[model samples]
Target: MEKKHMLQIEGLTKAYGNKIVLDNLNLTVEQGDIYGFLGPNGSGKTTTIRAVLGLVNYQKGNVILNGFDIKKDFKKSIQKVGAVVETPRFFENYSGYWNLKVMADFYDHVPRKRIDEVLEIVGMEKRAKEKVKTYSLGMKQRLGIARALIHSPELVILDEPTNGLDPQGMKEVREMIIQLSIEQNITFFVSTHLLSEVEVLCNKVCILKRGQKIEEGVVKKLLNKDYEVLDIYTPSVKKAMDCLIRDNRVISINPFSEGFKIEVQQGYADKIVKILVEDNVPVRYVIPRNQSLEDYFIEQTKGGEHIA
Candidate 1:
């Protein structure tokens, strides 16, 4: 089957008088993709999302979703797209189930059973009767996601869904996202500043800086380094270093706390260990230390901070 484009942005530019919020940005989100839109705070992530949803007007560019041009047919373009931007707000006094029912009323074809189905999809079925005021931040975030899914959208967009949650909450949200993507085959466009979470959750990513795209590609390809680096731990550091230094496959070796770090050809780690053990050096363990998404982001942005 051929892959389809779920969302496409071409020359998307938004400016406020003298300040430009988005500068000729172009992005393509493929079907079934968990695409991460990453950047520091004030990096035009929200503005781009708003433009895609037709909530904000752009000076120049086209926003096409599911093959419908947003400018020419806003309703048709957004019919199958659901989004929760920034922080999701709910009726504080209403029950979770009630809140979802109200949202379902807006759609004419949404069956009442969809409310229950969405609650189950988000793992909120058991607590569906609980009032919003009594829920924790994480639970509220999940509920927000459930509401977004109530319409059975083909594409779901979330803006900083894990913004203020605890570590465990963040983990729960990430797991939920992964589950939904696999089980339902829904495409997600998530905007977040959390680089670590994006590294694990998203298969594709686009990084923005100050209002322009700096990098965009598959996560693994973007994080790939020129050579593989490994941390070798053993009591006989001197002996192992001496042995590896003689091998042509070992590019370089640097002293580390436990043993040493070696840059070698990708498949040469096994040989290094074999040489070390043959020379009476005990091997504790070997850990591959690849360049991380955070490391690449920092290098591209040049001293930019605020991302977790």
Candidate 2:
């Protein structure tokens, strides 16, 4: 059997005034996939989402939702898609259940029990009757998710879903997204600057910068650094670098105060230690810097930063 995409963008481009926001960007989210759009703040992550949501006018590109072109079947394409970009607004005075009911009213087939089911799905069953004003930030986020799911859409898009969340709140939301993807088999298009979160939740991710896509690949594949980083504090930085650079396995050496960094197999610490000891170079400490998704992102897209 062949897999199909839930959303597909080809040669998508966008700009604001003289500055480009999304330049020839192409992406796809397969059915039942948890795809992540990741980059720094100014890397056009939000812009791409807006373009995909049809919230912005793109100068050129084609977006296909299932088999329907987003431009041709604009309303029909979005009928099955639900999105929450940035902070989701709600009726402050309305209870959580009431808010969901309001969104549910937009579609007729969704039953009242469906609202209850979604509330439970987001782990807000106990807080269903509570006013939105009384809800915490995490609860509000969960409510936003519940509202999106209220209509029982097949594709869900969320932008910075964990912003302003405490550690526990972030963890909870991450777990919820993962659970929904695995248990409910939902197709999720997630846009986030949180690389660690993307690393944890997304199977595929794209890195954007200055409106241009710099890299796109599977999360693990993009992050599978061929060489690990080894930092060693020694008495002579230059000498350490010179000796380490002789090895064919070493990629590059970055000099640091009182030490240097070697990009090589971290397990070969014994080889380095032995060399230094044999050469009578005092080795203060040898450490391996555990690379995370953020580390890989920074390494891949070296110049981008949080612009927004």
Candidate 3:
């Protein structure tokens, strides 16, 4: 089955005063994708989301949602889209159910049953009657997700959904996102600085830097297609280095705790072992360390110092 395009941004450009926040950026989010929108702090992520949701104006470009151009038909374009940008806000004194019911009023005809359904979907059904102020940040995040799903949207856009969460809290949120994607069949557009989370949760990613897209692809492909890093443990460190360094496939060799951390072009680890063993270099163990999204992100952004 072919996947339809859920969100498409063509030449989406935005400027503030004389500064260009988004520079003709192009992106496509396919149906059933958990798409990660990644960048450092000043990389125009917020601005782009604002433009897409029509909260802010753009200088030039098209924001297309489910084949409807936002500029031409704002209502239809955003009708089926739900967003929880930054931290979700709610009336603290109200019950979680009450808050959701209040928000449902914005739509034309949101039945009371939908409030219960969304609460159940987000695993907040048991605590539906609790006041918003009693909920933890993680619980609040879940409530926010329930609110977003209240409209039965096809796409949900979340900005730093797990921000300021503890390890367990983050885990719950991440698992919820994965489950929602699988069970509900909803496409997600998540903007987060957590590369590890993105690696685990997102299927595809678009990386930005200084308002321009630097890299975008399926996560697994990006990890495998790029250079492969290996941990080469050997008693003959100098000898192994001498033998492997001469090979053109070897990119770099640095000292790791137990051995040399060798980075080489893809599919060259076997050749490296062969050369080292042939040269009488004793190999203790050869462990292949797959390049992590964080590693790739750092390499692509040239040491992304601002990544939180």
Candidate 4:
């Protein structure tokens, strides 16, 4: 039997001053799944989060959490959700443990050990006693996560979780989020503009353009192996591309720092080499180009008509 869904949004619509931010949006996130939501600026990523969390009232559709309607019982609908929409507000002078304790007290019946467990889950148990002022930005972000998890929420929503971190900090948070999904069976729904971050962390994603979903699917299939990039560099770009300029298979050869960038038809490496050698153009290197989530994201959002 399939597990019960953690979140369900059907035909969700929200507008601001006659500006339609979300139009008949629909989505579902199951437990143990990390859904990456990507879109450009002003694409309603924040609006979607607000609607799901009940911070903003909407005119149409339903936002349900574990079958409980958000409109009818706000308490029940939010019980399983823990989200960090922006930077978490915390008392700077207090230690991490103290801050968590203060928040946990608001929700009666929270266990004593829950605070420590959440700190440990985010790898902050050792530093829990340290003053919040001394914590790094990454540490603060993790604390926000710990605070979110203090209630044992089934779904954790993070927006730009790694916004200003250095490389190591980004990796730290990324690994922690992934570990949570694997070890504790936590479900993550993250909204981010960083393509590589989403690609590395999320298994599925829903892309929005001007508040409308343009593509949604498993990351692996959405990127389709068939779209892999092929990088062809030649020492003599002008000479090498002379034979294939007018050919139907070759798109365009661009001059680059190392050599010339040759965009060829998909899976046409064999033909590219054969033509190059036949025309006496010295082929220096041919390798698969590493593509980030940004490439696919740009292709999906701005590749065609803009929808508002």
**CA lDDT, every model vs. true structure:** 0.90, 0.84, 0.89, 0.82
Shift in Å, residue 286, candidate 3: 4.4
Per-candidate TM-score against the hidden true structure: 0.85, 0.90, 0.89, 0.84
Per-residue CA lDDT of model 4 for 46-99, tens digit only, reads 889988898899989998887899899989888877888866667999999999
Cα lDDT for residue 166, candidate 3: 95
lDDT of model 3 at residue 129? 97
Pick by lDDT: 3 or 4, better one: 3
What lDDT tens digits, residue by residue, belong to model 1 across residues 267-299?
776677778878889989999886889889989
Candidate 3 versus truth, CA RMSD in Å, comes to: 2.5
Stretches off by above 4 angstroms in model 1 are 231-262, 270-287
Model 3 residue runs over 4 Å out of place are 233-235, 245-259, 264-278, 282-287
Stretches of model 4 off by over 4 angstroms after superposition: 1-3, 106-109, 130-134, 225-228, 235-271, 303-308
Residue 61 error for model 2, in Å?
Answer: 0.7
Please state the error at residue 251 of candidate 1 in Å: 4.7
- Candidate 1 displacement at residue 45 in angstroms: 1.4
Better of 3 and 4 by TM-score: 3
**1 versus 2: better TM-score goes to:** 2
By lDDT, rank the candidates, best first. Answer: 1, 3, 2, 4
